[model samples]
Target: MTPSRARRLLPPLALGSVAAAALTGCGPDPGEPWAGAYVNVTAYPYFDFGAAAAGQSHTVLGFVVADPEEPCTPSWGGYYGLEEAETTLRMGEQIAALREAGGDVVVSFGGAARDEPATACADPEALLGAYRQVLDRYEVPVADFDVELNDLQDPAANQRRAEAVARLQEERPAGTPLEVWLTLPVSPAGLSEDGEDVVAQMLAAGVDLAGVNVMTMNYGESRPDGQSMVEASAEAARAAHGQVRELWAAAGQELSEEQAWRRIGLTPMIGVNDVPGEVVDPEAAAALNAFAREQGVGRISYWSLNRDRPCTAEHGDPSEANDFCSGLEQEAGEFTRVLGQGFGD
Candidate 1:
């Protein structure tokens, strides 16, 4: 077994505490959890981070992946580089505004659409540098890695990513160490074998993992017959909690049930999921949120803030997954309002 990473002296901040600190104009405690939704950084019809959705002040801006052209360079959704994003998309300004408004953002790396940096950047130093650039540029306390598809199966890439992130955490000062979370795909049964390996690699590499956030949507054939999306999501999270505890035990760390739950995050794709006939309505979202609160789940988020609203005529079909809007009848931010309820309370 790989030696355990040196544990930080400071305890991780809870989701409520982090929100409270940010609202009070203080920097967040180095590590913990929070509730929010993913914002597709380069998606059409830009989202304003300064505005709180349903009084929820935190968000995860995502898909900062390797630039196809530069390989090691980071770009927003493979389109806008850091500087270009600031100018073209007002990316930096929006984040600054959000922080100024007593809100915080967690920059997410990788997504289903593009290659994570490790897939393209083979050099360990270069991979580390690529991650460093984004974290430093955002000045964020938390970073989420949404690993999926072929990228999740690449052992070389996963090793490089784990090492780079581990180094990133170790290099930071104790007071402001980086908190990393691995976002992986899951089904009702729990994390796939590859997903388990990903977590193991991070622990083995000494990445002080904040938690494992399973994408609880799109179970496909894994969804049991007659099960609702909410039911499937809840089952997946519950199963993941046990798997996470076991993984920690294998690494010489034993987490209690509550501790394990606090180390798990659930992110469901709101409205119409990519899979047919799977939908997370507002009521389902509320039920899911209630469950999270009751169980002390670490964080709650959806696939995107961008798609929280009902689809318009321009979006074509309301039954299909649309990037710009949730494919159902609902007010703008309704899902956010429901899911974010009591998040930091």
Candidate 2:
């Protein structure tokens, strides 16, 4: 995986250039609380810190480091940075503030819509180096790879990502491991083949993955009519756990169902999922929370915190997924409160 000398010459991301930071499960040290939600960095100030405080979602998974504008380069969705007009807040400063408030951040890379470094960076060593630079800048104990769709289907990129992360783990300081979670698309049947393969590849690459976070929402054309979203999510979690156990066992490290569950994370879209007619309401959130606790699941999060409130006006089709509200009838932070139940325990 050695890169050309020219590639090695590429400088690390300038710490000051990156914007806001994030958090989730910190590596195998196990004490890090896993309940949280994705918070977009640019949505800061508008993002309610009070809800996070109230819900006890001390860890936030921030989206995203889109893709390198160039090889081995890292940027926050290709727009946000320390530049004055890029964003009104500094990521480091905001992260510091969150830390001060007794919270933390874990930055997630890739998403359903963005180009990811694994898919874009050709040199494996350079890509690994780029990820290292991002971790160094953020100074967080966890990172998430939100691979989906095309990126999820690309085995080459998936293998490269696993190797890169394995290299990072090898370089970690003793007792200061970096937790890596692969967040992938899921359905009631559980992780798609590509999702299972990603986990297998990571294990094969010697990456001690901290967990697998399933995006258990928006089942879309795959979902049956009138199916409970909560039930769908639970089924998906169980299926994923089985897949992880089999993969780990095949990799010569058998994990009990409970062991696998502790490394599992559930993230349902808060209110209206992108799929028409699918909604994960407060009752569903409560059910998921109970399920998470009973199963000892490590993390529970929603699509976002910014959308924790009910839409108050006809800004758009309140029935669809939007930025400001959860598209459901409830007080602000209701979903947060229910889903984050037992958080910080």
Quick one: best TM-score, which candidate? 1
What is the overall TM-score of model 2 with all chains considered together? Answer: 0.85
Candidate 2 lDDT over residue span 209-311, tens digit each: 8788998887876777777888888888888888877877777876655567767889888888667778888888888888887777767777777678888
When summed lDDT is taken over every stretch of 10 residues in candidate 2, the lowest stretch is 1-10
Error of 1 at 324 (Å): 1.6
Show where candidate 2 strays beyond 4 Å: 1-33, 43-57, 66-68, 81-87
lDDT of 1 at 122: 92
User: Candidate 1's residue-wise lDDT over 1-345, tens digit each?
Assistant: 000011100122333432333222111222445678887766565656556442456778887899989999988888889999988878877887877766777888888778989988898998899999999988988899988998899999999999999999988988887778899999999999999999999999988888999998878999989998878888999899999989987777777766777788889888887678888899899988877877767788887787888887877788877677788889988888788777652
Model 1 alpha-carbon drift over 4 Å, by segment: 1-32, 52-55
Show how many residue pairs clash in every candidate, following the order shown: 1, 6
Residue pairs clashing in model 2 are: 19-91, 20-91, 22-105, 22-106, 23-105, 23-106
lDDT of 1: 0.79
